[model samples]
Target chain A: MASVLASAHPQETVYGQVGDATVPLRFSSLDEEYKVLRERAAVLDLGGHGLIEITGPDAVAFAQRVLARDVEYLTSDRCMMTLLLDADGQVVDQVLAFGREDGILLESSCGAGARLLAHLRANNDEGVEIADRSGDLTVLGLEGPYAWGVVGRLIDGELASLPFESVVDTTWNGADIVFARTGFTGEYGYQMIVPIEHAADLWRQSLEHAQAAGQEALELAMLEVRQPIPRHEVTEGATVVEIGANWLVDVTKDEFVGREAVLAAFEAGGGRRTVGFSGGDGVPAPGTRVWVNGQDIGEVVHAVHSVGLGATLGLARVDHDLAAAGLELTVGGTEVTTLTSPYIVPKSWSIPII
Target chain B: MTIDELRARAAERQQTCSQIKKMIVSRLDLEIDPDWITDDQPLFGRGLELDSLDVLELYVAIEAEFGVALYDSEMAVFGSVSRLAEEVNPALRA
Candidate 1:
């Protein structure tokens, strides 16, 4: 699946294959685009993310059973980020679930749509209607400390300050769209779910106010904020506890698809836990060994040269007792220091929406 | 540091983080177990999803529990349970 706005993108845009979709990796240089995303606003072509709709008499019931969070009373004005866990408590995808009048709409993480769609269908014992809406509907995003200003110029200023995860059905340039105050990079972010026909136009108009950022820059920002990247963080046999994504799972909910397994893992405890580290010279591979004074504890989950920190940043899943921040750990041949979450404090944390 | 010494240091920080997590869960009336909260997991806006009111409650709770006043601290101090550990137990900042 290619982005619907690919034609509107500059000819020099770099594209990469991520899972089942061929998507833009960067519109410009990674450093440049990442700077734009953190300092100002950057437009995003999120069409690579799959949108699946669930509607039927048993729609809410089906969603309740599959979603990791409790969404029993989710109204049309709200949306949430939750994990789609398999029966074994492994994450299938991290999704943005929107409450709709009919039932619900799920936006899968980039390029994981096909897998998420298959999972939804296979688990459709309730016989709810599952429609893949990616063909007609696509998503665009604005993110940065000043992204709210872009929303004011492109859409409505009032929509810019809507509480986090607030969704509204609105019109943009005579096209009906679903606008939501959703963020991935911890910036003041908003997503516009527009029709594929009008997507190019919206993308072009957005480029006037914000530079286009692609998957590489977006994912980098997400990593700095310790956001869970399903593809990189969810290793084989790793439970939700090891992924440090317990916040996404509503353990209070009685009977969701992976609830029992997740709770058991939490109760059983003493598994490997993920922690952030920065100091290595080069970007280490996913399976790089993490060491403590020559004793191998675990391996790296994912890593990259972080534009925000100007250093190599990575997540290491180590023995549970060794996962806290501020410890000195070794990866490959270099010494690294374990760090706290949000390695780079988002400029939006200081900048207000107004 | 030797492996055993590093483990001891990590345990100290983890213990502080656990206490902070218990304070957050109890002060905010969250239902999840205190141990469920990871040291590096975020505490505001995304991970724990604590709001401004929850922040106020935590501010009061921290000063009462740890005898440390965070009234003048920046929002980043509450970035995570581990980050908060550094704040309440400054020894962990080493």
Candidate 2:
């Protein structure tokens, strides 16, 4: 409805760069990347994140017991989203888990590595050891259009079949790296972690490699760091399902922590939901309230200025009755209608690029 | 916002002073008598160990009776039923 109205606060986060490495933290640069990302494609260099390696005879069993998702079935080329929960079923942390020939590696929200390693150690039994590989590894992202092609050409073995959630073990650029097909852009992307010394070298190689491939080369562009505000949002644990990622939850995933509580809450019948809204053609900030027929039903979780679709689109968790795409909502005291259609893809891009 | 009104709303949600007290006891793993929770003692206080998140659960429970708007104020106060009555009844009346 409204344009990116000049907000009181400008999103001016810093971008760190060294010789050739950079982490785009500012919204302007990030936004430019998002634009390039939609039109052609771009590979961003994410340097601050780290990694953890879980190894031992009982690594899978140990991880499954402590993690909210079952990791026993994890193979060399697949990744799983699991929550590391305290006994109270409250989140200790959220992690992206994967397994390969050598060990089960977990990359998490940065703050989780030490706490998770200690948790396993305190409760560890036979044949389990955890190591913080954050110092040992370097992370790289092959995002944008030629991401898969560049990676696909270098690595062998069914790389093309890797889906949004697939993780594979492969030797690329003469070193071992865990390739997880996932990213934050809601597109086809991959996040690769390898030896630290090779990090800068691989980054320079990948960029050099992408430009030579004839597609719009990945470049240094900024994107807005907008989280879906995680449905859990710390304060509203289990309160997130109704809004941000309802599709991500598998109510059928056997018994798990907070499963019963979420189901109980579901039965009791009031979980906030994410709906879509637009003010003629303006974007609303995430967490803006949604009102309908004099009732406060939900809030916005994702918003985008769609250049492709030519309209402002958003994802909000709203009242069940008002969930239909055409329903109207009052956000920040402004009236707008919720629409389910997205500004970009006909399908959602939830997994990271591998 | 009155104690009676809140109690009535909680009652509609099938919650009572005893039930609320029992929940507070069990949820926090405390052993105090359910009766130790008084209508006037602050839901959170110098004597109470409940944190901000516990207050959120309490607010969610109370929302079943009065709408959540009762807590949306400039000062953001919601401590006890009686105090809540003093705080919200005026706003409702105004």
Candidate 3:
């Protein structure tokens, strides 16, 4: 799937491993690509993300038992961010579940589709049908302040009216397409899923539409800066509470895969919380050791030079007390200060009505 | 109150507002200068554009700085710097 995108940018494109796939790390200069996303709209190919479908009479029940978020209450029009966990409360993957008439569609990070599908099958006592649809579906991300406007020109009906995490199935150029008001970027954005055969056509049309609207297309490098924490940071050993994703854990639910462990961890106060840090003279690469007064506290998970903030920003798992804003820490022998996530608060965060 | 006392009180209030503005910038690690934050500019929506989680950080900052614990019900006072200033002054006086 990525070969199609690679063929387009023969001069400036570079590929890197995201999950199991080698995706475009950048199409051109990182700063310029990032600038387009911050100032205007840009389209990104997120074909690596895993898509799985679970259907049957017991689909909702099976999902509710396995996922951290309350899947039982999710309706056909809405989507919810959830986490799949091991029995020991370690995070397996972060997933977004969209409720549809046939069943529930789950989208996970790259390289996690098979594991998630296997987990579902192992726990499926209710005869739910599970299928991995990653190869068949292509995910495209449209981001920036003007993303809504660009998407509005391509689809029917008013897209602005759709709330965040709302999913709507629509047709584009005689082919079926699904649009979700969800994105990793802390801006107005949408994720469009199309059939694999129509992906190249959709990608071309989306870029053309965005360019016609005086916007530039972006690549994965731009998207990385927008995300507060990368998925790799929360891999296998990390818990939801430790990652500061406690909001996604529905404690009111009677049971889930790792509910007991998570509850116990919550009561005991999980160690090594995820914190956002910025204002360092040098960008701390991922896996860099974070220190406090010469003591090794945690390690950097995601780091990037934020052109918008005019400083290097990174996310790390540090001591919980040090996670508060204004605390100073050392990364690679240089001092850096902590800040809250969504490092650059977008106008969308201000729109309380949404 | 006498004119002199009223003037003194106003000056003290202005000082507190300035302090809170600086505290907001420092505690939130805001990129902009403290002086850039106008009194009427909102702390959450539109102006500063802080989310609810950021508000939690601000709560901790306010308590640690002014020894005033902000209750959830008092969050309405965070509409603007002036509003927060108005709420914090009485707590400081107490």
Candidate 4:
């Protein structure tokens, strides 16, 4: 036990491990005080992500062969957002792949980890290995407009020199870490990947930054960053000729597992159509029926108040004709005018300035 | 054409799939002939053509069926038909 303690790296910081989450900052909702925290300094603990480290001779190639996107030429300093699909071409998980000097770290929704590891093993005959760091790696999200400058101060310049999506190693208050310019919250953010022993130090450091800035309105400003921008939701079982995600298939990449089938689905058009809806204040729940022209068209997938925009926003797959923007849609049973969205545009923090 | 062959084939390919395959089965209240939903057959887009949400529902079904919480890291394994069957079938009996 003494050796174990000796081997553990220590950093200077504090973190709030709230609720029942195994990780920190995994809050159900940002606190009212965070409004002050977000503008100046707000760090969140993302508990739902399962962190997995991949290392082996064939790690890169094996991943390339199985996933839909190409990661063949990724640099250790970059990150790629990609998807994993079934043989039939349905998406299973959307992932962020961070390449490191020794290996690649994949972070995604917590629930899918076990199934993801199983898939890796199935394709593992070629000499790749997967390690689960869900317990070992503690992830912290430091976000805000001022986040970059503050993190730069903390890491002593390693943060500023690194561009978004890049990963670098540096010592923070005496603890060694893998600092990546990656975050789920769209901000000039950084995700500090640390050993569990050092989490408290890092958290404390972030809290210090927030307090020092005195801008306390950090989390409230972050609300503007919380809008749910609909990338695409896989609409299996439901026809999907028009939700716009059908365009996601890129044939130029390595022959994906479900290429021909997706192409075929594309050709057979007339699938269900999806549309965006922005209501006044009422947030629609998933599976809530949608109506158009006095008939049931479809239902809501995922919806939220869109903190970034202040309007309720959602993505709904409906019958073809009504999926277009400007088409009126009511909550399957209520009166709600679905507005076209820009709903809340994200304030750009990383604009290139000469 | 037969149930055992279909089951074997499906159980073989279920790994390359998302949850869509199983979701359709449940929502439609349909059962594989055990000869169908096989590996040799096309299950996702054609013949089966499962979409993304269906894949998610399939994820829920597998968990409910196997009694194991599926995580995102293991998604690739559940990416196919055969693979999911391997995990799901055993867990069903366990």
Tell me the interface RMSD of every candidate, in Å: 1.1, 20.7, 15.9, 20.8
Using TM-score as the measure, the top candidate is 1
Error of model 2, residue A231, in angstroms: 9.0
DockQ list for all candidates: 0.79, 0.01, 0.04, 0.01
TM-score for each model: 0.99, 0.60, 0.75, 0.64
lDDT of 3 at A322: 50
RMSD values, in order shown: 0.8, 16.4, 10.4, 17.3
User: Candidate 4's error at A351, in angstroms?
Assistant: 7.3
Runs off by more than 4 Å, candidate 2: A1-13, A16-23, A26-28, A86-93, A110-127, A152-158, A161-164, A183-186, A211-235, A238-240, A243-253, A280-287, A301-313, A346-354, B1-94
**Candidate 3 DockQ vs. native:** 0.04
Model 2: number of clashes?
A: 36
TM-score of chain B of each: 0.97, 0.45, 0.82, 0.49
DockQ of 2: 0.01
Q: Candidate 2 at residue A159, lDDT? A: 65
Per residue, candidate 1 scores C-alpha lDDT tens digits across B3-31 of 88888999999999889988888988889
- Give fnat (model 3): 0.00
The pairs that clash in candidate 1 are none
Worst 10 residues of 1 chain A by lDDT: A345-354
List, residue by residue over A241-304, the lDDT tens digit for candidate 3: 6665554566667899999998887777637677667876777777899876677878887776
Q: Pick the candidate with the highest DockQ.
A: 1
List the candidate numbers ranked by lDDT, top first: 1, 3, 4, 2
